[model samples]
Target: MTTKISSVGLLSPGDMGHSVGKVLVHNGMPVHTCLAGRSERSAQLASAAGLTVNASFEELVQQVDLFLSIVPPARATGVAQQIADAVKTTGTTLIYLDCNAISPETTREVGRIVEASGVTFIDGGIIGAPPKVDGAVPRIYVSGPDADQATILNNHGLDVRPIGDVIGHASGVKMCYAALTKGLTALGTELMVAAEAMGLTGSLREEFELSQSAMLEHLEKSVPGMPPKAYRWVGEMEEIAKTFDDVGLTPKMLLGAADMYTLVGQTPLANETPETRTRGKTLQDVVEILNEALPKGK
Candidate 1:
């Protein structure tokens, strides 16, 4: 049986969530969001994306065919529990998708939460940036017993792919991929800040340009956009650490990466939102700001 998703309920409309909702709405799928405990910024984004705001989670579960949990990785489990509670009480058989950056074990635990209530649980991992209007949509990879149900979202401005019929497949991909991508960002931030402290920023940049040009370019594009998002990535890095450890690899690498993100999240740069980031901000800007914000003891 093919499932048709005519409506979706997006969990807090942050930068990524609102854009995702916009894509669905543009494709003629009605979208709604619960604003009960969200920020004013979230409310603004929801309004801009044309998302109808539901008063509470209770109302949300009853209103949509599916609910997409696109929150920070750390909150994924809690949100799943909340939705599960709502589903159990209402006895509504809706699909619940966990689309956060989490580990395979974590995804299964979330799956257990909703599936117990007779809700269809799909483990999903979103790669790439949020979809841009009239631009590219991010690929949402899903796995689990009910993974194929998510395919209904395809051709509706979302690139939905089914990796397997195992709950953790999608999450494993996300964990491994982000470990490399975000791990490199942390590594670059560390070296750049160290160079700035040693008054060797210029020399290192010149050297990197000569021998590590590709890496340098990646840093230029990735590092500047990291700080404000660093807080959210902290748990994701930890999740990656757990994923590595579970696979018999040493987790120390990503634990260090988690520490690096922790430091970045405390800097003044972390206060800047995606909307408030200066246009055309460069790697030099990020390096200098991090240099000034590095703890005095270090």
Candidate 2:
């Protein structure tokens, strides 16, 4: 049976969520969200994305056919419980998609929460950047019994890929992928900061330029772009750590990465949003800022 999705509900329109809502609206799907108690920036992003703001959570649950939860990793389970409660209170049915960065264990917990309320739960993991007008479109990998139902979004400005009929497959994919991309970013940040602290940054850059040019280039871009997003990545790294531990692998590396992000989150640079983070344009600038904030030697 095909699910007729006339309207879609997005939780809070942050960086990725707003762009997704924009794409859905452009593709002629009516996207709606409840901005009650959300940040001012969220309201601005939602308005810019052309999403209708529901007056209440009950109204939001009652109106949409599908609900996409794209929040921080720490908030994933909480948001799922909120949706389930809303569904129970309003007696409304909607397909619930969990698209946060989380482990398979967390995904199963979310599935159980939503499914217990009689809502169809789809495990989803989004890879790549948010949908842009002229840039690369992200792929939303979905799994579980009704994964095929998400394919309806393929041509609607989303690249929905149904990977399997298991609840955790999609989140597992995200865990492994982020374990590399973000994992490496954390590693690079640590070494670069260490080098800056020891005054070996110049020699390190010279060596990287001669033998590790590609990696140097990657670090230059990634390290500088990390501070604003580091706070969010802290929870994601912890989730990755959990993912690794579940597979009997050492989780220490990713846990260290979580600590690295935690340190970055303490820096003043982490307070800036992507739109307002204009201070660190170069790798050295970011490293210098972070190095200065480091605890002094006793």
Candidate 3:
């Protein structure tokens, strides 16, 4: 039987939310969305984005066949629980889609919640960046009992790929990869900060200058990206570190990565950087920012 997906309701409609809805609407799906608040501005964004603004969560649940969730992991359960509490008994063939960066254990727990409420649950993990404003293709990986529902999302023009007959595998891959890439970037940022603090900054920069270490490239790509994303990555990183720590898989490096990312996350840099809006990597710019914040006596 073809799983029909015509309408999608997105909770917490922000950048990713708006991006996903745009993709869905572009591909002929009717998307009803919500914002951080019921502010008039939020409604305007929804309207400008071509999404029907729902007055309440109940309206979203009652009208949509598929629910695509893209909130943070810590809140993933809360979002699911909120939905389940309201519409779990609706006897509707609703497919609850969770594409947050949560753990397998956490996901299984979410599954239990929806399954208990008689809702069809699908575990989804999004891998690539958000849907394109122009023509970029973002990948969304999904799997679970009715994992095939991911195909419905393809209506949005995403490169949808199924991992296997389960939810955990897709999330597992996403979490670990996030740990490595984001983890490494975090570790690099921290180490760089420390190096600068110790006057080894020049030495390290020389090393990069001498050997052309890829850290520069990483910084060029990572620093700007991490600042805005740090808040979200910190929790996920902690989760990844804990996952490895549970089995004693030597998470020393990853945890450090988490700490570093956590630090940069300390201050959310607006627009990645308003100082040199066009500069590629913060590098010296970031060093100045860090040093100024430090006491001179140290």
- TM for every model, in the order presented, reads 0.96, 0.98, 0.87
How accurate locally, in lDDT, is each candidate? 0.88, 0.92, 0.70
What is the alpha-carbon RMSD of candidate 2 to the true structure?
A: 1.0
Task: Give Cα distance to truth, residue 110, candidate 1, Å.
Answer: 0.3
**Per-residue accuracy of model 3 over 47-143 as CA lDDT, tens digit each:** 7568887666666788888887787667788888877875854555577888788777777788888777767888777776677755776677788
The lDDT, on a scale of 0 to 1, for candidate 3 is: 0.70
Colliding residue pairs in candidate 2: none
Error of 3 at 40 (Å): 8.0
Among all windows of 10 consecutive residues in model 3, the one with the lowest summed lDDT is 271-280
Best by lDDT: 2
Ranking by lDDT: 2, 1, 3
Off by over 4 Å in 3: 36-48, 89-91, 246-248, 268-281, 291-298
